[model samples]
Target chain A: MTFRQSPTRWALADGRELLFFTLPGHDCEPVPDRRSLPQRCAAQSELRFDRTTGQWVIIAALRQDRTYMPPADRCPLCPGPSGLTSEIPAADYDVVAFENRFASLTEAGGSAFQLPDPADADFVSAPSHGRCEVICFSSDHTGSFAGLDFRQARLVVEAWRHRTAELSATPGIEQVFCFENRGAEIGVTLTHPHGQIYGYPYLTPRTEQMLQAARAHRTRTGTNLFADVLAHEVRDGARIVARTELFTAFVPFAARWPVEVHIYPNRFAHNLLDLDGAELDEFTRVYSDILQRLDRLYPTPLPYMAALHQYADTDAQREGYFHVEVMSTRRSATKLKYLASSESAMDAFINDVRPEAIAEMVRTA
Target chain B: MTFRQSPTRWALADGRELLFFTLPGHDCEPVPDRRSLPQRCAAQSELRFDRTTGQWVIIAALRQDRTYMPPADRCPLCPGPSGLTSEIPAADYDVVAFENRFASLTEAGGSAFQLPDPADADFVSAPSHGRCEVICFSSDHTGSFAGLDFRQARLVVEAWRHRTAELSATPGIEQVFCFENRGAEIGVTLTHPHGQIYGYPYLTPRTEQMLQAARAHRTRTGTNLFADVLAHEVRDGARIVARTELFTAFVPFAARWPVEVHIYPNRFAHNLLDLDGAELDEFTRVYSDILQRLDRLYPTPLPYMAALHQYADTDAQREGYFHVEVMSTRRSATKLKYLASSESAMDAFINDVRPEAIAEMVRTA
Candidate 1:
């Protein structure tokens, strides 16, 4: 089936943009946010360059008071009815995306700024100029994205694709990240099943590292690093969790977490925007399958973070490949593998479980 | 008064080396480990090079079944008496250091290995070659490092200094990291007041990044990066938690954690070995003071990780500086700041508390 999405845009009471995405047969009417929200204050967030580690750290003190885990009946992501006011004004919706009230970065008008020279000053900081959005998978606040139907999941993917495209085009936005943090174990403040999208003004440390590795790999082996790695995973069937015509999911050879699975398109693609409708459909199926497998691994659902690594279509990013990494801190049914001194202080990770073992278990599940 | 330590060495039943450090005039006699421990097996830990990010990951599956939170009475770290046979055989001790039973790296006597070329093969792995040790702060096991008396704290410092010197001289060892994970919130498995020292075979990612930055700083400004940073922290004074003649403790300008403080020596030192007798004594005093202050920040003891970054005394590491970073996961008395998607997956940290504010709280704590 050819999947399609229909998006209708509206504004919250505080003038934050909200977009509702629906399947072909469904329609969304723009409803006014009746809740009385204070006027949006100028973001006090600042991007400070850490001279010691050569990385950028975002300081958003206002987020300390952001909404915590509210009751299911009073979840802010839920659609608001006649009396109960929520972040969403509509009584019902399919998939919705809106600006976060307490965001680390906001859409404050600013020109694209370069990383300040370390020798220029001992301390360097600039305005955190970007955007952060929350995407709700379904109006039902209890179920996770894995529980969504195929059509609903497809709509969510469409929303992600749209946002990635739009955010990538925004001025001063260098990278766009879409990720979901599930369960309180991973510090998901909100209980509702939702994900976050961030438009970062600078390249993240991990991305930069990967890009550098890829460039070096290309120079040494004359092939794209990610593509070569994915090809190797496909060739080695031991770590393969699931393989479809359009995509493959496997446990990384050097898996950092107890339970980690990376889903990659069978063909090379820069980001979600590069995928066709059929590929997205297949991706949604495989991605959901992996999440369900992770949930079934233990008695309780796995607490995990699903991150989508995408890149722009530029010459510098020519070797980049889009993939999804789903890793869980839950090592066993009752125990969690915490990042203690070694992992937290140093960037060295010691995995308690072998990738091959986890892959076998996930494949069977 | 001048301070000195006397270290006595012994062996556990399984042949693991154990050392006891006591204050001057306090003698420790060698005791036999009466426990019928199984013969020491070769370490199963393997270091796998992650091609995507060019980082090595230690895969130690045996660590999954390592001793967890055992009962207080059965604590292996406690000094054993006549009936009980713990890791420590003596009835009491001031400070002790021993090999970890479930070490991630062991002295299997492998020659120094280089990072396998990513272009050489699809998978590259080597034996995890190094040492992992546990340092008990006190034999009482009830109080924390902050609770140790001045003489006791000084002994612990002496033990760390000795370990750093010996481990640095070990074959294939690239870095020595001394760290403590305090409180269960930070995943301290044992209730005993202790720390760990890892003699990593490879330079950690963070250390590598810092060194690269330092190299660039020296080339651009003809100055040491860490020294310049410490000078700036002292000049700014706003983020200073404490300052002494030999050291300065302050919150980094771009602190990543909610409660983060860095203690730097006034003179540039590559590692603990560079410090003299007086500097070590002063460090012990200042370090203990900061820990006490951190404990007073909240009604409950703060969950923190104290990491001591040390480098080898070599021409390539001339710009490296020794410092201690003590950061807490506790954002508030009742809240914790978990590394979510941004921080964990992308290496981008979004801190909820400002550095200056945290410094103020620590200053008055």
Candidate 2:
């Protein structure tokens, strides 16, 4: 389970670093970027703060022009010939991570973009100074991360942990968000299997709320909020999907999604980097197992989003607990949960399915 | 515009009240439901409070089996003959409001559903004691609220104001929310133009956050948050879509959707009930104008959700501001702005369109 390998890093024509992670004996040769490309700093994003809700909104107008649902042959994520260059230069690779070409957040002062405050001086507007990267789970165009071999999945975990550690140390990066949007049903532009990492300049609203809850819990009761939640779920085994020595996967007591499963490490870990070799190996196994079970829920693929939540590197550890939340909009085989006004505008969830029932189905899956 | 009328109330066979609202001099008849229907208390929802985020999630297991996309002839929201009884017992009506048969929140203690506390005793679980009602915008099933004439639109507004006043006075009701989900793309079960009013037992999460921001702004600036926001928007007229004597419609400073327009009254009205005759008439024209503009943005009908936010009856009105938020998931002619992992999981929004550009489009439409 303890496979040691270092990623071979190279730069794209746009000066975006592309890191290739492979097995010890696998090919890690650098693939030359032959096509002319703009610099990684060609575009930047504007972050506007909403006074009503007190949340920062990233406005990236150019993102509308990003690659849409391209054919498999023309997929930018797919490995291709030098003449018809795609994002990945390598014809084949185990795993890779590269700076997103159409990133919502990039290095500040890039291009001619100016970070300006709103004219009123009350509404805060700033440069979206951070990083967004694409992590290709496999070189294959069609297969998904869940369909990856055990070793390949493990490599992905390693890539995630690696990116988390590196991105957390980046300048001005406050929070590291790692997530994957799978299946075309949920607006997946590309069919190629890949995940995304967003290193945000500010703590995301959800993470801030979570930290506030944890801090309040610590102040009220001398216990970590997440630890207590995990303990409560463990005691109430009816909602548990699976458990291992290092981790437990269960439907949250008040799950927002019809098919939501939260997996937490048994030990107190603030981020994926906290997991040791044995813990990482076991964690990978448990995660892959849960994903397989989720796919079996229906005859076809179950479109889901896997989100990795971790505390900011500069933030206190007392109220931070790293966890992975995998939620699917699919309420039934023929239907998907649409987050209309109640869920979207009001931030109130009306789940048609009970947590216990979802847990039972996941368990049987 | 000064026409006055009261809704005629009647009871369905299942004990749910059905109220008919119409223009003055319109025919108001009592149409009885002859179908042997199940009682309103046959099912109820459970409210589970999530400690992590401090939000209440409603678990309505029976809603999963609620009416789906039935044929237009068999639509439950439509009025039909006595032989084939639908939800609306009336043969014809201008606008109607009735208790939702498959309500997410309903009458307290009417059902035998046990409101059990979680086994851990710390996590809160209670009977979702509130009311959910449906407001039919018109008798014609094919046309939408946007297509309704000036008189009909005004009547619909009257119905919303009536429901808000009545629901807020109900026992245990804290916040009264009025919303309309348009188009099947956003999971509208019935093609018929209608809206819903949910009398929540607690202040919704979004409303709570807005109140917090307003309170903070007041403590810091010694001014009302909403008034200041409106002033700022008015000062920067670039984002204004339309303006009437009493209402101003504009894209929010930090709009989260590609097509988002917020209409706020010029006066500091805490809720819809506070609007006077002249304000109500002006508001109706402004709202209808905005809707018409939104529909003209694309070739086909735009899928959208209209959300009405008002002050909670139980909560203080220090920071409360009544406004209507109209947002569409439609990013372009073909693309949609999906609230995937980034938005849904993290509560962070990445809007693909700029507020000013959207304003220009809406203004010109």
Candidate 3:
């Protein structure tokens, strides 16, 4: 993101400031730490770019073999609270949200990053600031979010609302991301009926971009980008994957997933925590419908990475739109939709199935 | 992405120009198609924001699934100077770079996409103005980019250079991208060793953002963001993955991939085509070394989507860092780096491994 510049704007009713950045060009100049520390990249993970989308794609490919893929019978999430142990503890509850035993975002507070000694062969890690909570979509580990009934799904939403509010209230927590990766096809390590929550310490990249764009729009036009784009998509109706009164699910103008759809508030809302109870119920209705449609689209349950886009912005980004994304990798039931080179190296995209085609499929389903 | 009333400045070698936008706002509004008469988002793929790294991420998750898993022996790309049928004949090619047969951006212009009648069940399409070409990395059907020797690799670079230039010169072309999808693990339809090229007609979302950021930097600080960042990264080498006299490979400050390494030209160049034969040969040296190291790290070849980043300023971005990115999908050759909701949604990354460790492995390998 652009540093020290005017924060990126969102078209929210209450403007919040943000910073957004475009992809960098071909310059390979090393970025100096603020402290002008000696080259310390020797032992740290650094950000890198994927050329196709001109995006900063990550490479956290861990040794899958190193993981202790536990058996389903011995699932940690299903046990009662008393049974929970150091690694896999027992937890009880129909719809429970608890801290992940092995979390990427730890509660330990420290500098955003530890400067690794360039000469050191191994990188030492510093404290990572963020919250990771697992949402028990169902008490039965065998069951999944898809198997949940309407009321149960509503409970999940209630839990989400509670957690979103709690996490957002915490200082230094910039964005609240809620998402679920279901099915082993997409590499869900845990077969438990659970989703995860991330309380970010900084504005996420997506939020940053949205906030930045919104801020710019507000500064120039006193308008909201989300409002404008949503209106356009709705009016055009080509990429509209699904829709309800409260939420409209459509293939984003720029979709990174095969069957990607953003569930935007018909009206502007900055974050999901801001949604009221009635809104929550409405959200579950539309949300379940979207998932059901996804399942019906194919015989097998879809493998997807769905996220809620909640912008953390400055007052200028008040115009930003808060939306939930359902990015399905269902190129086919058995096959995957890989983000190959053009989509990775260049900032361009080529969707084989037209948007209208996707919309029709979702609409009919 | 912001179409503001303030005259948008374009930083060129000469004076600046005020750019205006015709995009809709938060609400979808009817806007005229800049291409031809009836407007639709037919050709240009929609770009999405990657919340973690503040970059646009495109989901080119196309319907190439069935093709992706085709019988390796029957690969059309492997049949050089032969005809599958009289209608579709192949030609001799040691390292072939041809218009992709099943292309998202076809060499032949796309079919006209018409708006569906309100009653039509299927309605999804937009103007598609781009070219999709396949660049065979080797003549051997089973050979991979990793198998290629330095000379063969250099030729691949040459083919890329030729294609990039040709695509860039095309009237409708706005961005020229070159990338490779090596293994079936990532769903390679054809087993032949090959890559892809896309000549975009419009500036992609990621490029647009980069250009905008660079322009802003130029206007405010009279410097390029990439130049500054690159200089800084070089000064602090902790994230540095590999280094060549002409290029530097390092993890980005905001890397999205787990083992994502950026190979940037020491000098400012928009993309791979910018380099001459000697430079490209050297580039191939590092490129091939990295790929070899990648394979050495894992017994099985990794599934990855790599790209070459070039500026699609539509003639605007000056301070960009054009680089080649290779992100290993073998986070653990056995396990994929599953991007949880926090990663996919918030754009905030939680890399499980320290970057320094990844680099050290690569450096030693």
Candidate 4:
């Protein structure tokens, strides 16, 4: 089947942009937002440079009053009925993306300045400049991404690709991250099935570190680092969870979490933009399969963070690889692996479960 | 009054070393471990080098069955009664330190071999070679480190100094980290008021990153990074939680957690061994003060991780500085700030609270 998506853009009561991605023949004409809403506070968030670790930390004090866990009937992500208004004006929708009510970064222009000498200044901070969007996988409030059918999942993939392309082109945006935080254990404020996309003004620490290592690897072996890693994982099949023609899913050699799996396309790709229709369809299938396997690991659904790593097509980031990393804190049916002293403080992870064992379990599941 | 501590060494039933640090004129004569115990398994943990991030992750499958949250009477860190064989065999003690039975690293001699080229090998692993010890802050089973008196707190400080001196001199140890994971929220298995000390074989990722930044800072400005940071914090009094004669405790300008503070000695010091008698006493006082303030923030005590970062006294580590970082996951009285997708996956921290506000609250508390 050929995958198709038609996105129609609309506006919320508060002037936030909303986009609906519909399958072919499922055209969406969103109802006009009628509820009165107050103007959003300007993004007062500041990005402070941590001199000790050379990383930027976002201090967004205004997010303290963001939405907490509300009842299913009160979920803002759900489509609105005639009497009750929600973030979405339409009574039903396939998949939707909207600007977050409480965002860490805003579209308001904030100029990045040259950092002063460390000896002379106490801190170097810049206004957090970028965008944050909420993507609702489905209008249903109770189900999860794992429960989505092929068509719905494919739409999510298309939506992610669309957002990535658009956000990357936005001014002052250095990176775009798409991720979902599932379960209350991971502090998911809402129970609705949704994911978030962040357009960061600076490169994340993990991204910077990975790029540095990739450069070092390229210098040492004269080969692409991520490509070599994919080849190595394929050669060493001990940790392979699933190997398809287009992509390979495997538990990494140094799996920090008790359950961690990374999915990479067989061919070199920098981000979702590089994938063709068939590759994106296959990615949706593999990603959905992994989430189902994770859910089957325990009696209850697993709490996990699904991270989509995408890099821009720039010369500096030419070595970047597009992949999806899904990791869970659940170590057992009843236990959680907390990031305590060693992991949280020193960034030295000590995993109780072996990578090969977890891979076998996940593969069999 | 001048402070003094006397440490007496003993061994557990499994031949693991144990030490008791007693206050002046409070000598301890430990009873022998009479219970029959099985031989300890050698450290089977392997450190796998993560090529993507250029970091080593410890994979210790043996720790899977290690004790979880046990009942109060069966606490392993508490003193044993007539027939019960807890980890501590002694009837009572002021403060004690003992080797962990479920150690991630051991003294059973595993050699670190050179890594094969990444292009040729799928994984690079070495036997985890180091030491892990548990330090109990008090004999009372229910009280916490914050509840300790001046003399007791002094003894704990002295014990840390002695352990740092001994561990740094160990052949394979590269860094010594002393930390406390308080409250069950942060994954403290036992309810006992205790901390852990790890003699790591390699430099931690955080320490390495800090040293790298320090080197760059030194090149940019001919001054020590940490000392300059301390001076900067002192100059910016807005984030000062507490200031003493020999130490300054403040929430850093780029605070990561909702509740985070760093305690540094006024003068430069590489490790606990560098502090003199007066400086150590003042450090203990300031640390205790901060913990108390954290406890008073809400109706319930805050869950926190107190991390002590100490470096080896070598030319390669001259830029390293000794300090204590105390960070709590709690954002409000009822909520916690979880490290979800952005923080956990990308190492990008988004703090909900402002640093100056938390500092003022802690200072006033």
Sort by DockQ, top down from the best: 1, 4, 2, 3
Off by over 4 Å in 3: A1-68, A81-91, A108-127, A216-223, A228-256, A264-268, A311-317, B1-66, B85-91, B106-126, B211-248, B251-254, B267-277, B311-315
Give the per-residue lDDT of model 2 (tens digit) for B29-83.
6567887887655245789989899788998887888888888888877875562
Tell me the DockQ of each model, to 2 decimals.
Answer: 0.92, 0.86, 0.21, 0.89
Model 1 residue B111 distance off true place after TM-score fit, in angstroms: 4.7
Q: Across residues A1-365, which tens digit of lDDT does each residue of candidate 4 receive?
A: 35454479998888888999987678676788888877877556888889999898989998999889877888888898552468888879999998998989876334543334334566888777778899999988888999999999988999998899888877788889999999999999999999999988888999999999999888988888889888989998999999899999999999999999999999999999899888999999999999999999999999999999999878768899999999999998999999999999999899999999999999999
Candidate 3 lDDT, tens digit per residue, B1-365?
Answer: 11222212222112111112112231112122121112222233333443312233433333343244456555655532333311113333345454443445432233432322222221233334567666667557675787887666766676676667656766656677787777766667776777777776555666666677667656766766676667766888877767878877776655556567778778887676567655676788888877877778777776777777776334575556688778765565566666556555555555656566677777777
Q: What tens digits encode model 2's per-residue C-alpha lDDT throughout A123-186?
A: 6888788788999999888878878888899899999988888888776777889999998889
User: Which stretch of 10 consecutive residues in model 4 chain B shows the poorest summed lDDT?
Assistant: B108-117
In candidate 1, residue B62 scores what lDDT? 80
Which candidate tops lDDT?
1
Indicate the residue-level lDDT of B127 in model 3: 38
| Best of the two (1, 4) by DockQ | 1
Per-residue lDDT, model 4, residue B108, is 29
Model 1, residue B5: displacement in angstroms?
Answer: 6.7
Once superposed on the true structure, which residue ranges of model 2 sit more than 4 Å away at CA?
A3-5, A40-44, A81-83, A108-120, A313-317, B3-5, B41-44, B81-83, B108-120, B312-315
Which clashing pairs does model 1 show?
A: none
- Candidate 1 has a DockQ of 0.92
